[model samples]
Target: MIAIGWVKVSVCFILSSLLVACTPVTPPHTEYDWKLPKGFPSPLVPEDNPMTTAKVVLGKTLFFDTDLSFNQSTSCASCHQPKFSFSEPKKTAVGSTGQKHRRNSQSLVNVAYNSNLTWAHSGLNTIEQQILIPMFSEDPIELGITGHENEVLLRFEKQHYAQLFKDAFEDSQASYDKIVKALASYVRSLTSFASPFDEYAYQNKDGAMTDAAKRGMELFFSEKFECFHCHGGFNFTQSSQHENQRLDLRPFHNTGLYNVDNMGAYPLSDQGLIEVTLQNTDMGKFRAPTLRNVEVSAPYMHDGSLATLDDVIEFYAAGGRGQGINNPLKSPFLTGFELQLAQKQDLIEFLQSLTDHQFLNSNLNYPPVSH
Candidate 1:
C-alpha cells in the first residue's frame, strides 16, 4: 500500500512539471528613461502604448526605412530631416510618388508637448492617429501604401526588421498597428531643450545667450511686440501642453495671411480649420507651431508662404497681409508694432539662439544601424 501511494504521487508531480513547462512566460516590461530637459514638464504618454526603450529603438528603424512606402522609395525621414529640426527645406513636402503637398511639413521638435498634431486639425490629438495620414492618404499620396499593406508587412518581415519587431513587441507579426505605435514612440522622443535660450533662461547659465539675443528675448515676450501672445511658454507656442498641464490649449489664429475676396476667405484648396469645422469665421485660422527651432525651419507659415524669418517678422510688424479685409477674423494680438533695424537684427539673433545644435546632431534622433 505504501509503495502504491508513492508511485501515484510521483506521477502527479511529473504531470504538474510538464504543464508548467508548456505554459509561456511573459517577459518583464522595459521602463523607458524620458530624459526630460530641465524646467520642461513631462510629456503625456498613452496608457495603451507605454514608452519603452525597445519600442523607441524599433520606431527609429521604421521611421528611416523606405520599405514603409509602396514603391520603397521614401520614408518619414525623407520629409522630416533631422538637420532642419525634422522639417524639410522645401516649401511643401513632396510625396513618395512625387506628388506635391499643399502644406509645409511642420517641425517635430518637442511634438510630444503639442495638444493637437497638425496645423489645423484639433481632432488629431495623438501621433498614432496623425501618422496614418502621411502613410496612406491617397489625396496627396505621401507614402502611397494604402493598397500595399501586405507587401509592406512582408518587407518588414525581412531578417533585420523581424528581429527588431519581435524584441520590441514580443510578437514578430509586423502588423500595421504595431508600426504606428512604434513610430509614434520614436517621434515623441525628439525633444529639444538644450538651446542657448534654455541654458540661460532655465539653467541659470550666464553668457549662454549673446547681448543681442538677450534684448531680442525681451522683445519676443513683451506686450508691445505681442509675439508672446502666439508663441509663448517654454515650448514657444500657445497650442502646447505637457503632462502637468491641467487644461489642453488648442489656440488657432487667423494671421490675415490671405483674404481672397476680402471676406476672410483663404485659398479654396486650404481653408485651414474651416476645412474641418466648416465655419466661415474659422477660415485662415491655423495652429501656431513651436518657435524653438524657427531659425532653421525656414519657409515659415502653414503653407511656407514666408520664405525667411525676416519675412515672417515683417509680416507680423505690418499686421499681416490683407489685414484690412481679414482683420475681423485675425487675432487681437496682431496690432502692428514698430521695431528698429537693429532691434530686428537682435530679434533674428534671438530666434537663432533657440537652435540646439546638440539636438540637431543627436545620435538618438538619427537613423539606427541595421544589426
Candidate 2:
C-alpha cells in the first residue's frame, strides 16, 4: 500500500511538470529592431497595425503595385519616388489616369512622426486618413478609383495578391481598411536614422560631417537665421506631437509662398489650411515637413515653389513675398532676415548633410519575393 501511494505521488508530480512545460508563454516581441538616433524619440506606431517584418514586406509590395489603382497604371510610388526622398519633384503630382493633383507629393521621410498631414485639413492626423484621399478622391482622381472599387478588388482576387492580402491581415480576405493599414505600416517603417547630422549630433562622432556642414549647423541655430525655431527638433519637423517632443505642436506656418491677389492670400485654388477650415486665420497655413531628407526632397514648399535648397535659402532670406508689407498671419518669427553669400552656401551644405545614402538606397524595394 505504501509503494502504491508513493507511485501515485510521483505520477502527480510528473503530470504537474508536464502541464507547466506545455503551457504557451507569450514570448517577448523582438520583431522590429528600431535603431533611432540618440535624442530621437520613439515613433508613434498605431495600435491596429503593429510593426512586423511580414506586414512591412506586404506593405512594400502593395505600395509599389500598380494594380492598387483603378486603371492599373499608377501605384503609390508614382508620386512618392524612392530616389527623391520618396517625394516627387513635380509642382503638382499627376495621377494614375492623367489627372493632376493640387498639392505636391509630401515626403515620406520620418512622416510617421508628423502630427498633422497635408497642406489643408487639420483633422486628418493619421497616415491612414491621409492615405484614403489619394486612393478614393474623385475630384482630383489620384488613384482614379472613385467608382471602380469592385473592379480593383477583382484584379487583386485573380492572383497571389489575394493570398498576400490574407497574409497581411491574418484573415482570409483583404478589405480597403486592411490595404490602407498595410500601406501605412510600410510608410512608418521608412525611417531614416543614418544621416550625417544624426551621426555628428547624436552619435558624438567627430568629422562625420564636413567643415562646411559644421559652419552651416552654426548658421541654422544662430539668432540671425533662427532656422531651428520652426525647422528644429530631432525629427526636424514642426508637426511633431509625440510624448517627448521638446515643444508643443506648431503644425502650420505661412512661409509667404503666395500673395496672388495681394489680399494676404495664397493662390485661390491652392489656399492652404483655409480650404478645409474656411477661416481667414488658417489662410496659407501648411504643416511643416521634416527637414531630415530635405536636400533631396525638392522642389521645396507645400506647392513645390522653391526648386532647390539654394532657392529655399533665398526665399527665407528675402522674407517671402511682399516683404515690405506686413501680413497679419505671417509668423512674427519669419520676419525678413539677412544672410550672406557664404552663410547661405554653408546652410545648404548643412541641409545636404541630412541625406542618408543608406536609407535612400535601402534594398527593401517594391514587390516582395520569396525567401
Candidate 3:
C-alpha cells in the first residue's frame, strides 16, 4: 500500500512538470525605441496606434511597396525619398498616374512634431487622416487606389504580408485602417535632430558648427530679422507640437507669396487656407514647414516657386514677391529688411547646418530588403 501510494505521488508530480513545460511562452511586448536627440521633446503619438518595432518594420515595407498603387509603379516612397529627407527633388510632386500635384510634397522629417499635417489644411491634425487624401483622393490621384480598395487589400494576403500584418497588429486581417495606422507609425518615426546645429546648440559639442553658421543662427533669431517669429521652436516652425506641449499651435502665415490684383489672391487654384476656411483674411496663409533638412528640400515654399535658398532669402529680404500689390492680409512680420551679401551667405550656411546627414542616410528609413 505504501509503495502504491508513493507511485501515485510520483505520477502526479511528473504530470504537473509536463504541463508546466508545455505551456506557451508569450513573447515580451516590443517597446517603441525613440532615439530622440538631447533637448528634443517626445513626439505626440496616437493612443490607438501606439508605436512598436514590428509596426514600424511593417510600415517601412508597406511604404516602399508599389503594390499599394493601382499600377504598381508608385509608393509613398516615390514622392518622399529618404535621400532628400523624405521629400522629392521635384518642385511639385507628380502622382503615380502622371498627374501633377498643386502643392509641393512637404518633407516628412520631424513630421510627428507638427500640429497640422499638411501645408494649408488645418483639419488634418493626424497622420492617419492626412494619409487618406494621398492614398484615395482622385483629384490628384497620388497612389491611384481610389476604387480598387479591395485589390490593394488583396495584395497583402500573400504569405509575407500576412505574417507581417499578423505580427504588427496581432491579427492577420488586412484592412485599410491597418494600412494607414502602420504607415503613419512609420512616418512619425522619421525624426531628424542629429544635425550640426543640434550638436552645437543642444549637445554642447563645440566646433560642430562653423563661425558663419553660428552668426547666421544669431541673425535668424534676432529681432532685426525676426525669422524666429514663425520658425522659432525646437522644430524651427511655429506649427509644431510634442507630447509635453499643453496647447497645440497650428499657425498659418501669409508670406505674401502672391498678391494678384492687389487683393492678396494666391493664384485661384491654390488660394492656401482660404480654400478650407473661405475667409478672405486667410488668403495666402500656409503652414510653415520645419526648416530642418531645408538644404535638401529645395524649391522652397508652398508652391515650390522659389528655386533656391538664395532666392528664398532674397524674397524675404524684399519682404515678399508681390512688390506692387499692397496685400493687407500678409503676416505682420513681412516688413522688408536689408541683409548684407555676407550676412545672406551666413544665413544660408546656418540653414545648411540644419541638414541631418545621419537621418538622410538612415538604413531604417529606406525600403526593406526583398526576400
- lDDT tens readout by residue for model 3, 1-371: 79976776777778778884433335546467789865567888888888888888788999998899888889898888888888877889999889999989888988888878788987889999999988999988999898998888898888988899998988888999989999999998888889999999889987999999999999998878878877978888884343443332447878877888776677888988888998787888898889999999987898789999999999888888854225777776777789899999999999999999999998444544353
Please give the ranking of all candidate structures by lDDT, highest first, separated by commas.
Answer: 3, 1, 2
Candidate 2 lDDT by residue in tens digits, 256-370: 7767666677777787878888888788887767898888888888777778888888878877756323455676556768788998889999999999988888834644332
User: Any runs in candidate 2 off by more than 4 Å, and if so which?
Assistant: 1-31, 239-249, 322-325, 363-371
TM values, all candidates: 0.90, 0.86, 0.88
Where is the poorest 10-residue window by lDDT in model 3? 239-248
* Cand. 3 TM to true fold: 0.88
- Compared with the true structure, all predictions reach lDDT values of 0.84, 0.77, 0.84
lDDT of 1: 0.84
Give a tens-digit lDDT track for model 1, residues 206-237.
79999999999899888799787678788888
- Top TM-score prediction, candidate number: 1
Candidate 2 least-lDDT 10 residues: 21-30
- Residue pairs in collision within model 1: none
Candidate 3 ranges beyond 4 A from true positions: 1-30, 239-250, 364-371
